[model samples]
Target: MLLSLFTVLLWGQQKETQEQLERRKQQILIEIKSVQQLLQNERTKERNILAEIEEQNRKINLSRQLIKNVQQQITITNASIKKNQKEADELQAELYKLKEDYAATILKTYKSRSNQSRIMFILSSDNFLQAYKRIQYLKQYADFRKEQGQEVKAKSEELSKALVRLEEQRESQKKLLAEQQQNEKNLQKDLDQQKGLMAIVQKDQKKYNDQIKKKQDETKAIDRKIQQLIREAIEEANRKAREAAAKAGKETTKSVGSGKNATFELTPEGKIVANSFKANMGKLPWPVEKGYISLPYGDQPHPVQTHLTIHNSGVEITTEGGSKARSVFQGEVLQVQVMPGGNKAVLIQHGDYITVYQNLSEVYVKKGDAVALKQSIGTIAANSTGKTVLKFLLSHNTDINNPQLWLSRSN
Candidate 1:
């Protein structure tokens, strides 16, 4: 009974492990595909070495992640194989013991085998009642022996099945190991490619540095303007909300303090939207249908220029050239502003929450236009450097949030 319970628990664990492995595998595949798209976009550029380096770095990181996930699967498979082997061993032992017990029962039955001798023994009883009692005892003994034989047969069949299952699990483990090895090889290849890219970057350090500096300046300027726009939008929304509240005879308190940096007091409807958006954190769809986050939000060391740290208020997605930037949620377009280099940005309001999509070539929605979830707002602009990058930002009132934290990880 203990062995049976152990087997049941182990099977449950194996099922759960398989599910976890499947989920990890799916995520890794999505990441690999996204990086491949980014690399494809980079290939179209005319000798932009920095872009190539960034793309290769992203690929290497993703490949490493894939290898890590494969290794984890292999680990899980190994554990399952061990558990299966242990269960098979336990079953085999139980079957052997059962066979031994059945052998002793058969020996005892052989000693009383002859039916004619048994009938004579019963006939030698003193009376009819005694003879009947002897017959009943003999019948019960025979039935007991038959039941023991059946049990032995059932145990043997069970042992055979356990052995077969153990063998299959071993085969599965072998396959998982082979897959992990292949992933490791792929990771090494990406690492080699990254090293080569790094060499090229080191040789052209000055030129690359200048180009990155220019790009950083442009990003900073754009971020400043976007933040300013968000501030203005918040103030405007607050003013309207307060007016609405006053007209409705509700006491309006400033949710955000008055000044350059102020938050918005939402109306009842806006509050609902804000709460809904907040609840969907880390579940929002990607701004682009297909892309990988090449540059993550906040401060980080450059992939090539380790000496320089780059501050990004939002994440930059490397996507296909013609891909359109989409709204991650149902929101109204706050404004569409053109940057210094003719790149357009669309800011969308989800109550107190706001999302900005930058580096767009054209706008599809005007200010105050309501947009649905996953609605395409504009086409992603391919910059003069031939890189199609989308800068995505998220904010709640005056505070900036990392877009990476909100966007779907698999998407």
Candidate 2:
């Protein structure tokens, strides 16, 4: 029983640690929401609703994970409790045996004779050998009785402590289970909020449909330009024979993955930025001062229809009204395009690393203009209906990134 109780106590400590992690996830979203909501009120931006919906989805996911963890813990805890009860039962039986033995020993010792009678009987021996033998026998009997009584007392004390420990374990399990239920309720609340936001977004669907179509066309154009850049790079590498022909025409064969991009023609600046991003994987700066992304980078479920899917090339961050989009690293502004959705977009080259900042109302830097890390390129679009989210993207030439994984976790 004691062992089982100790196991349960250890399990509860583990669950509490898991709960703390889940709580931290929730706290991050809440803080982000608090900042972005204030921006949404100031801007007439349509993308704010998108940001809100995405955050709600994140919270809901975390809550679901928490429920799964709690359920698992409950199963483990119940098994432990059953084992402990069995142990307690065995201990109680042992306790009863100890009591019976203790009582019988005392009855035999006391009922045998009065204290003076035992002494007198031993002293009345006829010789020295007889006296020594009688005294030894009496000591043996008395020692046996005292030992039995101590065993009974120890058993009772152990049983009491075990019971207390078991109760404490049970209480801990109950508390965790209750917290899990509360998380479910909170998830439901988030779902309702998302539904409301969806309604508002859908209401403006027709109004923004043409705008979306235009944006899509612009995005395709950008893709074509990127393809052109890649072709040019390949051609340039092929022409440079002194460069290693076996490895994309670079002087040195090198690695290009994640934030690192370029086989040939990697500028010194590109190498630095890639190295920095790698070194600071969990401490990269936020793209915007205060914003939340509505659209994420990847294939995602449509908010209105569960069966429908939407593919995005990059994540969209909604910043507050009149907030500016900033460069994440030192780079030359490659091009400034009139993007779809009636906003502006800027592309920057950091060695081989590239970043795209979209949904801007004005452009602060021009093509060929060198920009430093966190330098303002353009103000994020105002008149955003919900929240001002900055759609931040990182690229190693062409491959898209999951910004969530790349950026540092906000504390």
Top lDDT model: 1
Listed in order, each prediction's TM-score against the native is: 0.89, 0.56
Clashes in model 1: which pairs? none
Each prediction's whole-model lDDT (CA): 0.83, 0.66
Clashes of 1: 0
Tens-digit lDDT track of model 1 for 1-411: 997798789779878987887797877677777777667766765667777777778877877777777677767777777876777788788888888988998887788688888989899999999999999988898898788889888888887887887788778778878877887888788888878888887887788889889988987887788888888887777777788888989854467575456887876777788889999999999999877788889999987787899999998887777999999999888878988799899989997889999999988999989999999999999876677889899998878998888987757
Per-residue CA lDDT of candidate 2, range 189-222, in tens?
A: 8778778877887788765455545545665675
Cα shift from native, residue 112, model 2 (Å): 7.0
Best by TM-score: 1
Candidate 2 off by > 4 Å: 1-205, 208-294, 305-308, 317-383, 405-411
Candidate 2 lowest-lDDT run of ten: 252-261
Give the C-alpha lDDT of model 1.
0.83
**Per-candidate RMSD, Å:** 2.8, 7.5
Residue 107 Cα positional deviation in candidate 1, in Å, after optimal superposition? 3.4
